[model samples]
Target: MSIQLGSNQEPPKQERSAETRRQLLDAAADELLDGGFARFTTHGVARRAGISRGAQQHHFPHKHRLVTAAVHHLAERSLQQLEGITSDGSLNSTRRVLDALFEQYAGPLFAAMLDLSLAARADEQLRDAVQREEHTVNRMIDEWAHRRLTGCDDAPADFDELFAMAISTVRGVAVLRLLGHSQESVQRQWKYTRDQLLRLLVENRS
Candidate 1:
């Protein structure tokens, strides 16, 4: 759920700074989504953000900083949506949240993250940043599952591994779908994976 802070008043200077940062990150996300891994530049982002290059550098002195911030920014948004999805002890709630998670992985969020992931495989500096961000994201999801999904907190040690595997399988399926896999094949595999996870979730709660 969203929590609004402060009075319902006009924009303060600090709020304006926050808004500028948000706009820059959002523009970076759009650029990354459209341009893929190689097309992100501070100048391009500045142009897209309708701000000066000096302003961009003020917020992000380096390209890596910009990209890293953008990734974290987008991730927070995705996680917020994930956090908002309601779940109780029920199997149906588990299934719905799982489906929501799948959608989170299938969209531009996934696309942007995949770009960094691929780059990280070869670039050590980028790899370090990516890993750090990934750890944060994973930890957030793990906590979210344990807290929001009733049976998860009481699950065994293997629950982490099982849940992680479910996520990896979804990523694999997403890649295959991108490579022109049949829709029927994609749906079949998705069902099998999702159902397996859901079953495990329910069984563990029993």
Candidate 2:
């Protein structure tokens, strides 16, 4: 139940009882990645992580707790991966970030998560967490788009236009990829989409 923010030097440590909790989260992620949330079980996670069932309960106590925490952890990991991709200031850094994000869940894992997301509509808490994660990710993307678009004085007259276009373009690419499109096709279409969006953002820029 104890969490510490990162300090100036070393990484913050979790509470004494958090080791098992971390393991449960890791196991849940593997289960979700392999079989989606429908197949996720506390017992299965415990076995996968090499801990007792009671130990898993001692950490999660309920399935919902584990579900929410695992989703949050995945979202954070995705963000960190993006941060790494964007670390370099190369011309294709943004494209690299987008590609990296898509690469992680390129196959059945993405499909499973999307199915689980649809199924979670009946669960208000789970739905809210998913919405919040999506909001955070989209907000970051929007901010990056704004910065890139606003680099020059003669860029788009309205920031909202650029943000909306960026959001719509990415959403379209994701939907296409999830609907059984090949990765090669996704990459081709994504390149076109990215180029068009960048053109809109920097079209009139000095």
Candidate 3:
């Protein structure tokens, strides 16, 4: 008599492989966040992932490949989360949009990206890999913003420049948080920057 597999049955090999890869990517991001790029290692990631070193190497043989892949993986995950948060129609106003963007920039994903970017400055191969990953993520973000932002359809002539400035300002605040700044100070600075950007947007709309 043949037995039927229940919902609790183990996943297929392919599904398990994908799950392992996902875990490795998550662990890789955590390693970068906890130890930074300078101390990141494949063995460390494997251990953090609770997988064998050979398994980790099977997916990513080089450190640069692993970290770059992790960066892209985390970015994709973060964007999906952002979509869920913003799709509820609660982000109706420009201020709410700015708040969401700032929260995302200050999150662990951006923190990991910043660490990789700084390390890339001295490593040519890693720099190339990081640049490629960053370009892909930036394109994804641009598409997301176009679809979700409120004023894009009637944006100013220099909309891209203004948007770039907004992103830069948020990133600067995020870096300050990473450097152990006080919460009150960070929030104050972010409020000032947010107000300035809102004023610019309003002025441009006129």
Structure candidate 3, residue pairs in collision: none
Name the best candidate (by lDDT). 3
Positional deviation of 85 in candidate 1, in angstroms?
1.2
Clashing pairs in 1: none
Candidate 1 error regions (>4 Å): 1-12, 151-165, 168-172, 178-180, 203-206
Q: What would the TM-scores of all predictions be?
A: 0.81, 0.73, 0.81
Local accuracy of candidate 1 as per-residue lDDT tens digits, 14-131? 9888999999999987888889769888899999999999888998998887888787788788888887777765778878777776676666776777778888798888888888
Residue range 1-206, candidate 3, lDDT tens digits: 99998899998899999999999999998898788888999999999999999999999999999999988888888788767544322224666767777777777877778788888898899999998998888677656754555434556677668777777777788678877789899999999988887776544565
For lDDT, candidate 1 versus 3, the one ahead is: 3
Off by over 4 Å in 3: 1-10, 87-92, 151-161, 202-206
What digit string (tens of lDDT, one per residue) describes model 2 on residues 64-165? Answer: 777667766665565555554442323365455445544544544345557667868999877877667556545665555445434444544675676576
Candidate 1: lDDT of 195? 84
Positional deviation of residue 173's Cα in model 2 after best superposition, in angstroms: 1.0
